[model samples]
Target: MYILHRTNARPPLDIKDAEKSDTVHFINSRSKRQRINEKFDAAKSRIERHQKRWTEIGKELPPQINRRHISVISIGGVIGTGLYIGTATALIHAGPVGTLIGYMITGTIVWSVVISIGEIVAFLPNVGGPVGLAGLYVDPALGFALGWNAWYNWTIILPTELSAAAILFNGFFPNKHEDFIRQSNIVAITTMIFFAIVINCFGSRAYGEAEFFFSCFKILTIIALIIAGIAIDLGGGKEGFIGIKNWKTPGPFVEFRASGALGNFLGVWSSMNQAVFAFFGTEVPGVAAGEVQNPARNIPRAINRVWIRITLFYVLAVFVAGLLVPSNNPDLRGSASAGSPAS
Candidate 1:
């Protein structure tokens, strides 16, 4: 141990004083070094403690999902319920041309966003993903902003999923009493929320499993719809020889609130928001960055497929949906809620 002493008395102005001043200077230097060492040790300990806590939490979590599961989820994430139901309204408002243009533009934007997130998160693995990257590479405040926004979005999306499904479940019992429908929605919504919570409790792997299967179903549904739409357009439906009939009659363009090229452009611009809402799930894989088994290998592979995800799955689906239904169809104007244009 080193002893530190403080003195107020001045050294006498003599040759003897020179030695005393040198001794005092050496003592001050030692004290300054000690203080620096103490601070460094304190900070190191805090980091160790924080890391320990994080490790404990990691231990409690269920088996982390691998690159493959996340990849499948990412591929199918674009097929949200909004695409099926909300596209009807978009068709009515923006018309087929506008909706198709909107999807293309938004697809480019979403592709950029996914690539950015993937690159950043891949370089800094086993961390908070985007939030951690933001703090490390940019300002800590940016991290906080992004983190809170993600939390808020996920919190709201869970309920929205349940509520939308519950309301749509009423189609089967159309003749049921109004009271029965109300009770059924309550029961269904609560059960769905409970099921989701239980999956979360099991861990991220369980959630991944659930989403994986659901995504499979969604992917199949989208594929089937595209096929069905093509068949329908090619006279496979009860209505014979309906090939591009809607497009020709509706003129492939409609002047929105204002009539002309500007209105057509505005229609596409306005539909961009609808496209964005459907695409919100495209970044879901970013949330699981910390637990990913192979960030370097998996992250880039999944991200590189952005073109396939957006163009093949989303852009194609929107194009098919546009071709299947005409803009003037009353169903597109909201008489048929939760029903697709083909229905």
Candidate 2:
């Protein structure tokens, strides 16, 4: 142990005094170094304590996902069946322009949230996922609330995705009886749930690989759609030269459950629910920060690509869907067999 002493002295005026001043300077720098070392040790201890707690509980998440896996997952998370099927309902409730506006607003919100989260994750990737982070940085109560809120959200979303898959499956057997359709839906949902459980049980590496494949597939699908949309807009479809005709004819907005400007406002407001659902998992990369290889480097890189994904996959997709399909098309409200504005 060492005692730090403070000295008050006049400026050095001669060689002998200069030597004393040098000694004092050295002492000050050594003290500063000791303070930094103490802070480093404290921070290291905190991280070790967290790791020990998780290890004791048998829940320590090992780093298994690489940069590519994490990046693709974040990009594809936002491009789900909700974006595929739910947007049709948005179009019906609010016209093309209104749906576009709703999606843009939601995208902006997602971007802001991910940017803030990215900075924190780059600094400290695993204070535990978002739940642990909230407890550490904010309040324990807020962390508890977020934990339960996430649980509730996932619970609902799981069933919703399963149901949406079943609906899409039913599209193949259009002429089948209602009873047969119901049975097929049950089978599809059960099969998917079973596969999901099996995949997760295989451990984090397997899960990351699986996500990487699916995310890549989704990315390709969106890219294809973007190209097709451009072609269709440029008079490649049967409806030649179909520029912004939908916008002009439908008048770019809808009146929902009422008449006049208030109704149109309501329409846009209601459409936000669909947009929110579409963008629900945009922060998935942040959630997986703990398991990402070299998270301090990878997490920020993955998050930086979020805006690109949003602009290309989501915003552009909505723009194309609006241009191609009219909001008034009764097919928008028809059975799930009709299959999305884009479809």
Candidate 3:
């Protein structure tokens, strides 16, 4: 029997009729493919244009750093009050050898982390610094977390540094009224902050100049301290200098518990934590990677030097301090209620 299909777009097709309509379906599929191709081509062209524009803009921007400034800034960034004032306590806690080992371990770890960061900064140096680096190499979330945390840390640190400077000043002027000291410190810190902002805002050269002077001061102070300490130890000021007997006498390693090696390990770990805190600012140079000149060259140089610099300033400082004043001495620990050990 023959079956007839009536039209209204041929009604519903039976199996045989559907097979005959495959040509129509093929035409529709080809048309959809053509539309997709057009959309992809347009998108590709748009992206290429955007990329070219940005490349041109990047080339036009002025270089933000020079070698001299970057070198000095890196040094200044790492050398701060922590090395000067905080080393004594770590010495007392860890003893000379333990303190040295603790700083070396932490410093090495910190330098390793910084070197990984440096690899990225060398490729894309910009004012945004590590925040920008994080966003590029990692993710937006990580970048945001690091950026804000770093900013907050610096904000807190500025005031703390100012407070320390004030206390140091008061040491030289013992009879000054508290109110006067406070006001004077406020002025001095405010002036320093203002100058720093101004210099940074002007250009890298100005910032570099400021950093050079800052580093020079720190270097001079350290040298003088080392020289004087040696002189005092050698009996320079009339009382014949006492040698390294303090380390051997009070003992280089102190036993916190009357137990086993595990107890000693825990004790040393606790002492290491304090030493790590004192050496924490060594990462400042890593943060300055973006502002560093010839980052591929200078940055790696700076990162390579961090371990030695930290070891010398922090570990050596503790060693010298221990030599001058034995760790076990009650006076070195001071009283919990009292101010810092240096005071």
**Number of the top candidate by lDDT?**
2
Off by over 4 Å in 2: 1-48, 51-61, 173-176, 335-343
Clashing pairs in 2: none
lDDT of 2 at 324: 85
The digit string of per-residue lDDT tens for model 2 on 109-161 reads 98998999899888877777777778666666888899999999999989888
Model 3: what TM-score?
A: 0.70
Q: What's the lDDT for all of these models?
A: 0.73, 0.81, 0.62
Tens digit of lDDT per residue, candidate 1, span 203-292? 677777888888889888888878988888788889976876777778576677887888887788777888887787787677676666
Taking the tens digit of each residue's C-alpha lDDT, what string does model 3 give over 80-174?
A: 55666556556665665666666677767776777776665565444356665565445557878988998898788777676656555555554
> Candidates 1 and 2: which is better by TM-score?
2
Best by TM-score: 2
State the weakest 10-residue window (summed lDDT) of model 2: 22-31
Which pairs clash in model 3? 235-241
User: Which residue pairs in model 1 clash with each other?
Assistant: none
- Which is the better candidate, 1 or 2, if ranked by lDDT? 2
TM-score of 2: 0.81
| TM-score of each predicted structure versus truth | 0.77, 0.81, 0.70
